[model samples]
Target: MMEAVKRFVGPKWRQYLAASLASYGSLCTGMSMGWTSPIFPQLRGPNSPLAEEPTLQQESWIGSLLVLGGLAGPIITVPLSRYIGRRWLVMGSNLPLLLGWLLAGVASDLPTLYVARLMWGCATGMQFATVPLYIGEIAEDHNRGALSSLFLLFINVGFLLAYAIGPFTSYWGLTACGGILSLFYVPFTWFIPETPFFLVYKDRNTEASDVLKKLRGTSKEAVQAELEGLQALVAREFKEEPKISDLWATRGNVKALGICVFLAMLLQLSGIDVLLFYMEELLVKVGTKISASDGTIIMGAVQVVTSCITPLVVDRLGRKLLMWTTSLGLTIFLGLIGVYALLDSYYNYDMGSWAFLPLLCLIIYMILFTLGVGPVPWILVAEMFPVKTKCLASGIASFMCWLAGFIWTRFFRDVAASYGIYTAFWVLAVCCGVGFVFSATLLPETKGKTFDEIQDMLNNRSKEPKPVAV
Candidate 1:
């Protein structure tokens, strides 16, 4: 049995398995993000367990506080991962997530629930900033794009699980299921090796070589050659500790940071967090015949299916094409939604007969979103920066993303209350249009390129500053 297992599990199996384990962290994060969708309405419903039903103001805080915690994740994760290594940090993140779910499962008051969510948010922040770094270091060039995309795939899976199951379970039951995810993730993630790049950084060349061999399923000579190349690349790029100022110091650095920050802003502005937090409410408001919970599940299913497409085609179709295609699609769908909402509100046009329209549009919007804006930004963040500056840049970009999410999630109810939800959809549509323009004119195609090659392209493009037409 041992011989058969050894023969069957090839060298690349280790890389695939490690990436999968890292993705489970994303699963937990997604569960945390999606939990409120089901629980919020329940807490406000008469069957609620709270001493008093939550007001809209309190509910908004519950929805937005996770982003607040996420905003703090990068501050700690960047330095922690740098010192202790990515694998341990990844393993350690599960503890807080588990605790968060446990607290949510048995909480007698809203304050306890808030603390639970904040803990989950912090774990999410750590996962987002660190998982990509780990995957980027371990994956071979040929499989890197697909492997990195798995992070998003698992996230959508978690979202789907939460939405699909939340309506069927009691509050504590749902929380228990979520906690089970973290519990399983903890032990499984323990076995994956630390990234070869980090090992080399610590001057453990021999161990790096062994890890490379295991990851690549290659012979000793091939592993040695790969290790030498990595050593040369690291030596050339990482002479000093990376600084925040390095993001602004050089032309390439400035351009990379600008694109990443813009992408992060565009991601949140596109309304993902809004949709996740309020999908059930939005569906109900649209007067869909479908139950709010059912609509949310359907949306989650669409997201998972579409997100799965990205890993298969990201390397083949290249990042630029996917970005533009999905951005344009999002723009059209969001615009239609805004138009529908406006017509229903002002013109008193009865939309009940066509209630399915908003649902259809939302489902399509989620599909396009998961395909492009959802996963591509993280992939680009992992790809665009130099190794030395990658962690800092990723942390800064992630902070921007969570901050935007915090603002949007916190204020969306106010905006909808004041200007109408149509206005919110219109605003998101405009953001999508802007993102399309950025992708067409500014973003470089990084398909099949080595890290050095990508850096060279950015440097050369920075020198001339010409836009690449779609």
Candidate 2:
């Protein structure tokens, strides 16, 4: 059995294990995001535990607070990862998540619930900022996309778990499950090795070499050659640690930062966050005859299945192709949903028989979304920057993502109420259209490229640079 396990992990057991552990953190993030969907409906019901059921305004606060809390994660985790190492920092992130889940399980007041979600948001930020950096450093170039895309796949799994289980359990029971899920990440983290990049950065070359040997399952001679190449690449590429200002100062840095930030914003603007947060509410508002819980479950299932397809083909099809496809698909579906909402709202159209259309559109949107926008941003963020600038740049990009989520989610209900839900969908559709143009014009292909090669490609150095010998 041990031999079987070892054979399965192959030459890259360390990388695979590290990614698996970090992905569990993403799973917790998904659970936190998906929690609102099932719990919101329950809180509004007559049998609610609260003395007074939350008003719609309060509900928005409840949903948006997670993003608001998320804003702190990049600020804290990015720098902290520098000092403590990525492995421990990620392991430590689970503490806040577990506490948040436990608090949610027993909370009797709105304030308590708010605090719990805020902590979960902090964990979300940590995962987003740290995992990509870790995964980028550890994986082999050939399978990097397949490994990194696991981040989104696991997130969707967490979402599906919440949607499938939350409705059947008490609030306490659901949260207990989340807290239990957080615990699983700890044991996994123990066996996973730190990235050789970080070890080398810290002047621990021997340790870095050993880690490389373990990760590659290679002989010492091969590991030494691979390590030397990495050392040479790092020496040539970076002279000093990157600062926040560096994100804009250098031409290459600026281009990379801009792409990361824009992609992050586009992900939120695609309406996935809002959909996950208020899937039930949106279904009710759309007057869909499909039960909200059932619709939410189906959406979660579709997201998981579609997300699985990306890891299989991302390396084969290339990043640019998927981004273009997702952008076009999102634009069409979001626009269709807007038109449906417009007709329903203004034309006094009864959508009873055609009720399934909105749900179908959203499911299709989720499918397209998982294929690219959902996973590619993190992959690109990890790929584009020099190692020196990776953590800070990724943090900035992540912060922008959470900031966009905060703004969109906080006011989504108010916007829908004041301007009509159709207007909100229209705005998202416009964002998707812009995304299509951006993907076509600015996005670079990173398929099957080494980290240094990607940086060179981004800088317009060469399209066919000789492969870095390993």
Candidate 3:
């Protein structure tokens, strides 16, 4: 039966399945992140389920608390990633996500809602901390970029599900959708093999080789060649045994750390996550010709479609190209929206002739964003560090990302309330512009490169940049 299934799935089926299942973690996060956009209206409307409409401060907390909860997630998973291995860590993350949604479903007050979001954040943090580690381990040198980009693809799908369903369903029904999806993900993960890299690191050579055979689905000679190469690479990278403190101990590791952290910060500051969280509210403020809910649905659909196309092109176009192109595009569109917001605010300039500009600008921005900034940073982070420091290094980057999201989402309302949304969009445009420079000046192209080669590139092992493999 297993052989028949393997034949149907092709040679790389295990790698694709593992990545697909791991991405379900990101799917839960998208659902939770986009949850606020549609439901905030119901919660704040005249027919509210809570005893009262939440105060502005309370609303901010409700929106950002999941990110706040994400802050604590790495503290738990970074340590556990080594002890339990990547497969189990990913499988275990689903428990908290399921519980978080269930809690949100039963909540009658602000505090319960806060705790539920916090739990979801923690689950999200854990997934980000480990899935990239798992992905980096399983992917072939030839297809790493395409496989890693799968993370954001499913995330957009989850976002579309929430945005499409939220307007039509009751609050409890949406919460149930989140809970069921998370619960549904658990059993599928049980079939995937533990990463061969993790097994090699633990000196389980026989099991590692067996897993390699399953993953490659090739002749024993081919599997053994890859396995032997990995064993040698691990031995070299893990010299003297690494600790968490080593995340900043060596200059090379520190360089990798700085690059990944900066990229992660740029991703959040590009205004993608916060904008998704507040899509409906922003559309209302911009006063689009179409209804806010309809606009949100359209944007979500675009994200889902573009994200699928990105994975097909990322390996071919290369990382730096996509990052630079997307950053430039996001900057221009964000600046355009800021202009409309400025006119709409300071001048009370009625956009009678140009009402479509805001939505059009937004739709274009989402397209460029989904192509690169949305997923590439995660791929870049996964490629930067060796397994020895991956958990600690990736965890720090993940922490910075969530911190940025919390700061941006938590304060966006206050800024929009006082200065208008223009202020925030203009600020984020500057950030995206900086992202363009960062990609052009500092980021390396890792397309089709092996992990050993990437580490060598970071360590300055070669005077010239390695050419992207055909």
Q: Give the number of the best model, judged by TM-score.
A: 1
State each model's CA lDDT, in order: 0.84, 0.83, 0.84
* lDDT by residue for model 1 (159-184), tens: 88889888888787778889987889
Rank the candidate models, highest lDDT first: 1, 3, 2
- Which pairs of residues clash in candidate 1, taking residues 3 or more apart in a chain or in different chains? 11-217
TM-score of 2: 0.91
User: Highest lDDT among the candidates is held by which one?
Assistant: 1
Flag clash pairs in model 3.
none
Tell me how far the alpha carbon of residue 416 in candidate 1 is from the true structure, in angstroms, after superposition: 0.9
Instruction: Report lDDT (Cα) of residue 280, candidate 3.
Output: 90
Give Cα distance to truth, residue 196, candidate 1, Å: 0.8
Q: Each model's number of backbone clashes? A: 1, 0, 0
How far off is model 2, as Cα RMSD?
3.8
Q: Return whichever of 1 and 2 wins on TM-score.
A: 1
Residue-wise lDDT of candidate 3 within 1-470, one digit each (tens)?
65775686678878887888888779888899899998898898875668899887888888889888888778888887667898998888887788889889888899889998998888888877777778878889776766777787888888888999999998888889888888867887787678998899888989998888877877677799888998997898877666878887766688888888887888888888778988998998875778888999999999988887887777678889999999989999999888998887678888879889999999999998887887787667667776677777878888998899899889888987887788888888999999999999888888888877887777788757689999
Q: Give me the overall lDDT of model 3.
A: 0.84
